[model samples]
Target: MKLKFSEGVFECIENPPQFFASLGNLHDATIISVARTAPGGVCFIIGDVFNNFVDFPEYPGEFGAAIILAGSTDCEWTVSASHLFGKKINDFEVFPAHSADAKYRLEIACHAMDRYVMNFDKAEIRIAR
Candidate 1:
């Protein structure tokens, strides 16, 4: 999968190894870290936000950390604001758009996916999908 950022940054890693290398750099640079789940799918990690991308059909919408990231391999890649959670680590603040503390939290999360943030509201991301 590929990621598109609002700052004109676009990245795509075709294999697991490449994904690892990119993730390593992001981690080392204190940028963002993401990993392809061993079983399947992908996960993005930030301070308390750990968002996992799952197939839409398995979970139609956000119920927690699990979210619909993409419709299909060839479909638009998307993320929902409602899907972010940090309860696993005891941080319960859901990523919000209007909060002074979270205005750019979504953008930070996107960096983990190799995507830069754009403006949007709850339950949806700005990325075209």
Candidate 2:
């Protein structure tokens, strides 16, 4: 699927599982499966580590990590990360591209995260966000 986030573009491929974020390369990524971390706290993780395999930094290689975001049932959103290099990986406040409902569907969560991540990492290339 091709997703547009503001001025950024991302090509998401399920095969081999990667998201290409207009960095002139493709990242070997893993979109962490959706899971409920706490009561009413639904989230999806995306980072370099996938299926117990850790992605190492490689020169000339595409980015292997990403920032994750999510909207609460009330439409309030947050941003966090597994690995962000110099940037803080801890959870922080953010605004979703669209309003979220009580349904809490996986597709909606992934789409919201993708939209936020693409814009956040637009200038970041081949780096673990």
Candidate 3:
């Protein structure tokens, strides 16, 4: 998947070996780190995982996963299985319309699974303006 940035500063990495052993069927995992390019942009970190499957004689097309992140805003973002498994790790530097000091929040919605796991050791966020 492709992550759109507001400005001309953004970067991405797919399944870094330091964090995960292999992408395997878990292709939907991503580590998104954002930085502030201008004075009005904010930076944050997002880690997500998604999985879909079917149970014999029980459930079909069942899905489960978890989302995790850290930042300074309170806005909510939706995540889907396709976006998680289909996209790559996207890191970016953005320039928002608001001030850099503005409130920022990160929300992670964990699906079918009871919990979502994130290895912060392999993920981070930095802001410079």
By TM-score, who's the top model here?
2
What's the TM-score of every candidate structure? 0.19, 0.24, 0.21
Which regions of candidate 3 fall more than 4 Å away from where they truly are? 1-71, 80-87, 97-129
lDDT of 3 at 28: 34
> On residues 1-129, what C-alpha lDDT tens digit does candidate 1 reach at each position?
333222122233223223333323222222123344332333444331112333323322221212112211211234442333221221112233454422212233333353334322222112222
Estimate, for each residue in 19-128, the C-alpha lDDT of model 2 and write its tens digit. 32132122334454434433334344444322122243323332244323233343323444332212312222222224334222222222234322211211111223
For residues 32-114, write the lDDT of model 3, one tens digit per residue: 44343232333333333222112223322212222222233433235433343333432222222143543222223333331
- Model 2 global lDDT (CA atoms, 0 to 1): 0.29
**TM-score quality measure for candidate 1:** 0.19
What is the Å distance of residue 37 in model 1 from its true position?
A: 0.9
The lDDT per prediction is 0.27, 0.29, 0.29
Q: Which ten residues in a row have the lowest lDDT in candidate 3?
A: 120-129
Worst 10 residues of 2 by lDDT: 117-126
Candidate 1 lDDT at 44 equals 48
